[model samples]
Target: MARIGYARCSSEDQSLDVQIARLTEEECQPIRSEKMSGASRDGRTELAAILDFIREGDELVCLRADRLGRDTRDVLNIVHELDQRGAYLTVLDPHITTRGEAGRIVLTTLAMVAEMERRFIKERQKEGIAQAKAKGIYKGGTRRVDREKVLAMHRTGKGPAAIAKALGCSRMQVYRILDACEGAQTAA
Candidate 1:
């Protein structure tokens, strides 16, 4: 049986050092980590890789249940998948594991709490943005991509993929900009 570790963070700005250190302290081998939101299981390649390669009797370790997932259903699904593979999930913070019924119960409760905390965070963020707007100090989020440049590229008959490659942005971003420009023209 092996102890494998998985660490995750919501954004690129967040550090995974603490989680990695804790996992190392736990003697977990081949630790996998990623900088991605835990709100959902989508697009989490590292986590998916761990799940795919995990074998029976292997323990999946994380610093906390929230690191595994912020959504209750997603956490539960992960636990279920581990169970099916005869693997276990070990959470360090509350010291919960999926090796027993009690651990499963505690993990479930913690998962629910984590989901609630995520919702509360979103609500607080919305309230803060609203307050900022009321104070006339909210300039809105900074654009990571230049809309005019994207439009210029599109006007030059560049495809979404080509424009994205040239601008160093995702094809989705290029498509969204083009769609918005088209909508604006239709409205005008």
Candidate 2:
């Protein structure tokens, strides 16, 4: 059984050398590393490659569960795949290995917490966006987006969905402006 090690750091300011050291101490053979944000599926190529290489009786070793994936759904899928293949996952610092029933339960709990944390972050971000919009803040520090072309597109028999797609605005914004245009037309 291969005990493959994985390491990652989300930013340039962080280093993977320390994680490598710890995993090496644990005798995790053939360390795979990446310096990229684990914010989503895009940054998980190395981890996914390692998982692909692993087979039944293989073990995946990482410094921590967070090191594996920031999003719970990501690792939960990995864990389920591993479970199906009769493979094991070992988090060195946490000292939890999903090689048995009890280990599976612990991993499941962590996955749930990870999912909850993800939802909470999304909620906070939504509220922050609402607050920013109320204060006339544009995302990415950009100027206010013009909706003129969007309006023209709508006046030409294009639906709000199409206008929104072309303008890169939300359907709600498109609907709001369309309603305003209709009201103006009626008043005139």
Best by lDDT: 1
- What alpha-carbon RMSD in Å does predicted model 2 have with respect to the real structure? 10.6
Alpha-carbon TM-score of each model against the true structure? 0.78, 0.61
Give the local distance difference test score of model 2: 0.77
Task: State the weakest 10-residue window (summed lDDT) of model 2.
Answer: 138-147
lDDT of 2 by residue, 65-181 (tens): 777776777787888888788888998866889877787787767766766776788799888988999998746544233667867786699997787667655555666777787
The alpha-carbon lDDT assigned to residue 30 of candidate 2 equals 85
lDDT of each: 0.90, 0.77
**Over 4 Å off in model 1, which ranges?**
143-188
RMSD of each: 4.4, 10.6
